[model samples]
Every structure is written in C-alpha cells, then in structure tokens.
Target: MTRTTSALVVESAGAEPQLALVTLDSLRVNGVLVEMYVTGVCHTDLGCMEGYLPVQFPNVFGHEGAGVVLETGNGVTDL
Candidate 1:
C-alpha cells in the first residue's frame, strides 16, 4: 500500500517553502516508518532555501525531529 504524507519542501532557491504532499511506497529491509510528532527547521534548511547550500529542488528539510515508529520493514528486529 502507498502511504501519503505532508511535508515542508523547498521547491527552488529564493522561493518560499511549500507544504507538499508526498507518497511512500515501500521501506528498505532495515528501515522503519516514523510518524513525526514534532519537527524543527534549522540553519541548514534556511541555507538550502536561500541558495547558500547546494541541494536538489523539491527536497525535504528539517533534520531535527522527534517521531514514533509506526512500522518496521523486513529484517528489522529491534524497534
């Protein structure tokens, strides 16, 4: 099943961040799906949005976050 979620995406340099809808198809063998409760945007995110940092467009920022594990993929033993 495909899972859909909303995220803050930087579409381009010098552009405002956008609320984007994203879809997840499957997880890696050792990956776990997370349901984020709180997220924080840092200086890196700002730099990326302002073109100071080299990054691909439509990238998801906010590395500082807290979340709960919703599902674990195959071969994942510890939760």
Candidate 2:
C-alpha cells in the first residue's frame, strides 16, 4: 500500500498556522487502521494557536476527527 505524509503543522515559533500538505511517515497502530478523511478543529487547537496552552513547537494539533478503517491489528475481531 502507498503512504503519504501530511499534517496540520505549524512552521516557526508564533507563526500563523497553515495547512501543510506533507508526505507522512510510515506509521502503524496496534489496532484497527483508521484512515481519517475529515478532522474537526477543537478549542484546544485554538488555545495552542493563541498561546493559551503550552504546546510543543510545531505541534500537530487535531483531536476531534473522523475517518475510515483501513486495516486491523493482531487479535482484532470487531469491525
């Protein structure tokens, strides 16, 4: 299968956030493979942007998300 690198990444310190369409690293999860199509912006993300919450530099900020399952891990039975 093909893989792509992408993230809603920040560039520099205190820079305006931009949509970064980047090639993603090969990542694996020990469960159902979730292929995300649309992810919603949460208040926490805004907090990171506005310097309210302390976040790591160049943070990939998106939690409330929805996606499709692509693969399953070992011992996975439910679908």
Best by lDDT: 1
Residue-by-residue lDDT tens digits, candidate 1, 1-75: 778999877788988878889998788889889999898989988898889989999788887889988989899
**Which residue pairs overlap in candidate 1's backbone?**
none
What C-alpha lDDT, on a 0 to 100 scale, does residue 76 get in candidate 2? 72
Which segments of candidate 1 are over 4 A away from where they belong?
none
Give candidate 2 regions above 4 Å deviation: 1-3, 21-32, 75-79
Clash pairs (backbone) in predicted model 2: 4-24, 5-22, 5-23, 5-24
Candidate 1 to truth, TM: 0.85
Cα lDDT tens digits for candidate 2, 9-37:
87655677777776644444456657788
Clashes of each: 0, 4
Reference-based lDDT, each prediction:
0.86, 0.70
TM agreement with the true structure for every prediction: 0.85, 0.63
